[model samples]
Target: MSHEIRTPLTSVKGAIELLTDERYFKNNDQQSKLLTIAHANTERLLTLIGDILDFSKLDSGSLPMHFERQRIESVVTQAAQNLRTLIEERNIALEVLMANDLPDLMIDPNRIAQVVTNLISNALKFSPSNAQLRITVENWQGMVRVGVRDHGEGIAAENLPKLFKKFTQIDSTSTRRAGGTGLGLVICKGIVEQHGGQMSVESAPGEGSTFYFTLPAAPAGAPSTTAEASA
Candidate 1:
């Protein structure tokens, strides 16, 4: 389905790109504005398509699970670093807090990284400029808990239950403004569940929000993937 839909979407995007080119539209102010709008919507369409593909994999249980021994501190730091450009562009402070002796987690590093990146990205999107965005890792009741906190316009009490639902939009006006497929949190929750973890959010209308998840730490003498593959 994506293949068929993307072909036409690509054609539309290509035309918009050419029309919006500054060199070509230099003297056509009205045309340039229209083309710019088209270009932005096209980009949003492409993102939506990508999100659909991800959600399909997740829903079908086809998303591959790669269990690895991942250091809690390093994984989230790298995820945040991967998004450093976005954070810096928005002028937000990015902080990662973890104890020096935190234990490694038994999980898929890449998928976990995706969750971290998504949470931080969402936080950055809603947060005010110059606000502090924090990613903290701590040991909680024998599990490793990671939280992404953002000082943004918090969600309402009634909307909490719909957060992880597929294609959920808390506010249509806000959705149109933000331009997301809304499958991100659903995919994040699916990944965490596949790893036997739990994902949740905490927020109030006036205060900020925190999205956090917990995963079991790798047990002592657990066979590492590298060694298992070799054997």
Candidate 2:
């Protein structure tokens, strides 16, 4: 991730340097457009770095979790909203279907949001334009299951088992086409596990894919704590 950020940072600096030159200023239109692209790439680099740092903290058991009862629907809604622009840009149909009776469970809202965002972002990347991404939350046997379904080029059978491995890209060529550091799902898995959740993916080639995770329901009359919850 650090290496990935440096490329964009270097590009942005170069673009800025050119923009500062008097000759470049005379042809500012094209230069300005390049600067815009550079700015966007810089933001992407920063986001990737943040994800890496968060994942590192999680792995080292240094990440802090503020556990409190939070409405599941609200968390899902917020995550979907965060990715609205990406969804629109791809012309994909993004839907959130939340069960009205979902219980307020103790969790770190930000971490949960990160999980949702990662899953949604991955879905958008692999999915065809105009395909649908469905996010659904439901209560099942005292646990909340959130599933992200994408109608994309589904994972190959040989690659399914390696999906969560850090820096392991199932489709190496597709990584460049998809435009990500490939650590997104690894980070999502670490976050969900820290929150006492189990994440799993179900997919077959050409059949689309669904990634679902389950978080245990808060025990009856039990107070929430920062201590890790068991999956």
Query: Worst ten-residue run, lDDT, model 2?
Result: 222-231
Put down candidate 2 lDDT per residue, 25-71, tens digits, no spaces: 76467866776777677777777777677667767777777787777
Q: Give the per-residue lDDT digits (tens) of candidate 1, residues 1-231.
A: 868978899999998887767777563778777888888888888878877887898887677777887787878888898889988998998877886667877888878888988899889888888999988899888888999999988889899988899988788354456768779999899888877789999998768899999998888998666321110
- Candidate 1 deviant stretches above 4 angstroms: 1-43, 172-175, 226-231
All candidates: TM-score? 0.81, 0.83
lDDT score for residue 2 of model 2 = 52
lDDT of 2: 0.80
lDDT of each: 0.83, 0.80
Candidate number of the best lDDT: 1
User: RMSD in angstroms, all models?
Assistant: 4.0, 4.6
